[model samples]
Target chain A: MIFKIAWRNIGRNKRRTLLTAASIFFAVFFSCVMTSINRGVFDKMIDDSVTSNVGYIQIHKKGFWDDQVINNAMVYDQQWKQELAAIDKVQTVIPRLQSAAMISFGKITKNVLVTGIDPAAENKLTNISNRVVDGEYLNADDQAVLIGEGLAKKLKATIGDTLILLSQGYRGVNAAQVYPIKGIVSFGVPALSSGMVYMPLAAAQYFYGANNLTTAVVLDVAGKEDVEEVLPPLYAKLDTNNTYEVMAWQEMIPDILNLKQTKDSSNKVVTIILYFIVGFGIFGTILMMTRERQYEFGVLLSIGMKRGQLAASVWIETLLLGLLGAVVGIALAYGLAYYLMVNPIVMQGEMAEAYTKFGMDPVMPASVALDIFWEQALTVLTITTLIALYPAFVIFRLQPVTAMRS
Target chain B: MNIVTVQQAQKTYNPDKIPVHALQGVDLTIEQGEFTALVGPSGSGKTTLLNAIGGLDLLTAGKIIINNQDIATFSDSELIEFRKQNIGFVFQAYNLIPVFTAKENVEFVMLLQGKSEQERDTRVRELLTAVGLADQIDRRPSELSGGQQQRVAVARALASKPQFILADEPTANLDSKSTADLLDIMLELNQKENITFLFSTHDQRVIDRARRVVTLEDGKIISDERVS
Candidate 1:
């Protein structure tokens, strides 16, 4: 009976109910949009910086990350790659032998990081073929190099041009190679696009006087979320006993993670302010509803309805309104977020230029993650529930004769 | 058998500042099955005395004993329970719940009493029929005429089958025909079920139909007359 009464009571003043619901609707919608955009930008940042090149999880010699010398390089073992691949969610294990060297073309000489890779495996990890702008992609038997677009531009070199590489190899042996440039590849990160050189594994190992050696084994997973699940097994399977170090993407990219955290903290402050406004809007409506129904409450009391029952009815009424608003808000937010996700907002003018200069994508997309919807809806409902306590308090303190007189 | 007894009932409004006495040392007793009227002008303590007897308001100083239970000894919650079981009320403005249909209003009290659905349905139909609103049971208060709404109020008041029904100016908003029709229904219910009624009103029509009339003046009862 109380539920029936509460359901009917919400229809008593349609305008008031709509106004209250509108406040909650907008609060949920705006909060969802804000959080979604924030998360979407950070997800893109991780995709560009970490996932595309270094993979989400990496395995290297124990001190290789701290000291990138050839001495710290581990022997490239197929058995280790097979063991890592057996772990769940390990999509691919890419091997790379990298060292810093100076490249000279014509009269210009610039320092570049030379990376030795298996062509097929490296393509799976970074999709290098799709990023090639100038010439043919590298083949396992091809004694050629894929230079970054910025490096190619700086050296005034193109396809069919030979570039000289000079560096100290394993055990201080002089490592020098002259390889024809097969292609020019671009990267979203300015640093990589400006100074990266890719060569086949056999050629690079022979030139560096270190056969069957690799500096890092990059483990590609489906997404950043899979890193945690794949880490424990990888640790147990590999020789982590002071021989190798397993690093997740977050441990590799502290700067980007810190940036996301700072943005998230600000988003929380804004969300708090929005919910505060929503709370007051709902409280005002409840106050008016309670005052208008004071006489009716008195009659119900006089007719033997318990105060607790009456208060429960009023609270249920508020919850019904809140639920209605929240459901609608979620639906609307989902539609908008999904649309934005499919077709992101493209930056224009100065913003686009700035983003390109920084080697980042200029477009902004909203995250369509399901949790964002329910989390915002739950928060608004909680605010409405707390606001509803006002009516309960009034009903409990009401005097039948006095309220009826009013 | 006396259903209610009041001794030295005193109610002073705003006692701390310029107090106005609404009831002063009033004493009265009502018996079972009696159709009684408490008649007075405005501010003459008729409603105040009615409120006191109905346990809607606390007496400043007095003892109102109903069915041998001293009501002043009951807590606020106990008084609500006591009223639910023992007293019914009809107000001047026909205080039917606006959101409810006539049938729902009548069934509301029984629902509070936690009566079974079968019991509530049977009693609600019976009471609405008794009030001459049998055909208007499905209409909400806003849809019904003032007199019909008053009839619904009467049905609601009797839904709990209380010891007595207290009505304060029930006919104040009704026309002559509605007033007469309403009175006829009440008189029939009174004689047929032996149900007791106590009314506070200035309407001469209601006064003429009552078997006993008590008149108040300046917060005190001035006359008690029993008509044949």
Candidate 2:
């Protein structure tokens, strides 16, 4: 019966209730959108960072990550490869034999990071085969090289042209190789595009005199979120002697992780400001609601209704309004978020230039995670509950006789 | 048995600033089954005395004893419980909950008392019938006439089976016929159920029906007389 009264009382003044509820509704909607956008941007950053550079997880020699030299390369054991492939959520692993070298075709010579890769496994990890812009991608048995577009331009070399690579190999062995470029690939990152070379794993290893050795094993998982769950078990399955270190993408790029945290903290400030404005709106409406019903409250009190009970009923009324607003707001926010996710807003002008220059896509999308919706809705509802204390206080200190006379 | 005793009651509004004394050393007693009226001109302390006896307002000095218990000693929550179990009130404006039907308005007090639905239903029906609102039970206050709303208020006041009913200018907004009809219901309840009735009114019709009339002037009782 008290619930009935509280609900019906909400309808007694439709405009007042709607104004209050609308404030809460907008709070939920804006909060959800803000949180969704933040999550989407962060997700995109992580995805680009993982797929373009770090893969989801990486296994490196204990000291190799600190210094990337040919001497620190470990043997690429076929047994370890087959065992890791059998683990669940392990999509594929690509072993990279990387070394710095100076390449020359004719008169121009530039320093480059030459990567030795198994074509099929590298394709699965970085999709490098599809990124080939000119000529064909290299095969496992091919002695040909894949040169980056920027590197090829610097060397004035085209497909089928031979480029001379000169560098010191493992244990300071003088190493040199001349390889015909089979493919030219453009990378999203300018730095990578300008100073990269790819060759068949056996050919590069034989040339560098570091046969069957790889610097890192990059592991691509089924999904980005599964990295943490798959890491400990995968680590246990490999290197019980602790000769290798498994690093997640975030650990590999602590600078990007720090930047994301800074953005998240700023987003929280925005959410708090939005709630602060909406709280005042709700407070004003509830103040008017209580003041307007002073006579009715007095009547109820004088007729044996306890002030505490009356105050409780008023709180229930505010809760009902908050629930209505939150549910509707979440529904509306979900619709907008879903639409944005499907047709992301394309960036233009300066923003597009800035994003593309940094090797990231220029579009802005919204995430449709249920956690974002629920968390935002609960926050707004808590604000509504806090605003309700104003009316509750008014009812608490009410003097029935004075109220009735007024 | 005396249902209410107001001993040397004194009431002043805004005592800290400029005190306006509404009641001064006023003494009154009301027994069960008595249909009494506290009559006075405007601001003559009749309503203040009624409010004091009903435990709705605290007296500046002196004590109000209801059913041999001093209400001044009770805490605010205790007074609320006491009122819920003992006293009922009919306000001047017929302050029925606007959202409730006549039946719901009457049953609400009993609901607060934690009466069972079956008990509340039977009593609500009986009281609304006694107040001649049997046909208007389903109608909300807005849908009913002023007289009908007042009748529902009276039924609501009697729903908890209170020791007495305090009415302050209950007939002020009613028509002549509505006033007479309201008086008839109160008189019937007084005669048949021995329920005490106390009212503060300026209306002569309410004064005429009362068996005992207490007149107040200048915050003091000037006369207390009994009529045959």
Candidate 3:
């Protein structure tokens, strides 16, 4: 009966109901849009740092991460590859040999971190092959090299062009050689272009003069297993005689994880602020509603209504308003998120390259997470309902006789 | 059986530091099945006395007994419930809820009493029919005539079957013919249902028909006459 009365009362003031619901609608809608943008950007950042560059798992020589240019560079590439291949959820394992080297092209020489990769095996594991926009990648017999687009532009080198590389090889010996510039690659990363170079594994091994092997193995796994769960098994399979380490990508990419944490904190910051503003909007509507119905409340009180019930009845009105607004807002936001994900708003020129120039995916993406809708809707609605207590309680304390006398 | 009794009641208001004592230790008693008139000129305390007895206004110092329970000390909620179950009021202005229809206005009292659906509907229909508003049951207060609106108030007053009806110049806003018709209905209802009726008014027509009359002067009852 209380609910019946409340329902009738809401219908009695159509304008008040509309105003309150509109407040809730806009609040939830704005919150949905903002949260979608935040999540979209964060998800893309994570994809660029984690999924594309580093696999969920990576294997390395023991103590190499701590002191990469030191004694831990002591692992055989073939044995480790066979042992890693024995595990399930291990999609592909590609070995790499990295060295700090000085390379010169004619009169211009630059210091670089030279990466040695098995062209065929690395192609299967990473899509580095597909990134080649100029010249062919390393063939079976060719001592070809892949250089970042920026590095090539700086070095003024092109396909089939011979570039000299000079570096400190094993045993501190002077190592120098001539390798053809195989391809120039462009990635989203700004630094990768001018600083990094990829060479054939056999040629690097022959040039370094100290190994038939690699310093670390970068493993790319299937999604069936996560980092923490599969890394332990991969470790047990490794030479635990302190010879090798099976480190998860989480360790290698601490900066990425830290960045994600910061983004999450900021996401929460934005969500709270947006929802709070929405709350104020809804609250204003509820205030107007209660003030307009002050006399109605007085009548209900005089009619022997329990004050608490009266308040509950009013709150239920907001609940209905919230539910209605939430459903509509989420539905509208869903369409928006979908449209944006497909026909992504493209950033033009340097702005697009700037993000990609930094190894960050430039496309903005939005998630259609349902809980986001429920969370935002409930938050705004609950706040409006709580504000309703001022009016509902007013009825309890009101002197019906005096109120009527007015 | 007496449904209400008021003893030594007083209500004072201060306007610009000059105290206007509306009721000063006024005493009165009303019996069931009685049609009583409280007569006095403006500011003579008749309305104040009626307000105090109806539990609509608090007394400065008094004992108000309604249906044998002292209600002067009742809390706001308690007084509201007491009024809902025991007393119905008809104001000179026809105070019907603007949002509700004539039938819903009549159902207001029963709604207060927490009557079940079937009971409230049955009682509301009976009262509206009695007041000759059966055809106008769905019409809101704004749509009704002065006489029709006052009749709706009367229907509402009787809806909860209250023991006493307190009317403060109920016919003051109506035409003479409408006033005569309303008085006739009240007297007929009083005789048939044994529902007590009390009015605070200066209208001699009301006083002439009332079985008992109480006249007030200077905030106190000056005469109590048994006219029947």
* Ranking of all candidate structures by their TM-score, best first: 1, 2, 3
Best by TM-score: 1
i-RMSD per candidate, Å? 0.7, 0.8, 2.9
Question: Which residue pairs does candidate 2 place in steric collision?
Answer: none
Model 1: what TM-score for its first chain?
0.94
Residue range A253-356, candidate 2, lDDT tens digits: 78878988998889889888887887787777778888889999989998888887898888888888887778888899999988988888899999998887
Q: What is the number of backbone collisions in each predicted candidate, taken in the order shown?
A: 0, 0, 5
Q: TM-scores of all models?
A: 0.93, 0.92, 0.79
Candidate 1 regions exceeding 4 Å error are A66-69, A209-212, A238-241
Candidate 3 per-residue C-alpha lDDT over B58-156 given as tens digits, one digit per residue, 9 for 90 to 100: 787878888778996787777777777877878787878776789888886777677898998998888877777789999998899998999999888
Local distance difference test values of all predictions, in order: 0.90, 0.88, 0.76
Please give, for residues B119-226, the per-residue lDDT of candidate 2 as tens digits.
999999999999998998899999999989998999999999999999999999999999999999999999999998899898998898899999999899999999
Taking candidate 1, what TM-score does its chain B reach relative to the real chain B?
0.99
Model 2's C-alpha root-mean-square deviation from the true structure amounts to 2.7
**Which ten contiguous residues of candidate 1 chain A have the minimum total lDDT?**
A45-54
Measured on C-alpha atoms, candidate 2 has an lDDT of: 0.88
After superposition, which runs of candidate 3 have C-alpha atoms over 4 Å from their true positions? Answer: A1-27, A55-99, A104-108, A116-126, A135-145, A156-183, A199-294, A314-331, A360-362, B13-19, B72-76, B91-95, B103-114, B175-188, B203-209
Q: Write the per-residue lDDT of candidate 3 for residues A236-310, one digit (tens) a residue.
A: 766756776666766767886788788778878876776677666667766777776666666555545557767
Candidate 3, lDDT over the whole model: 0.76
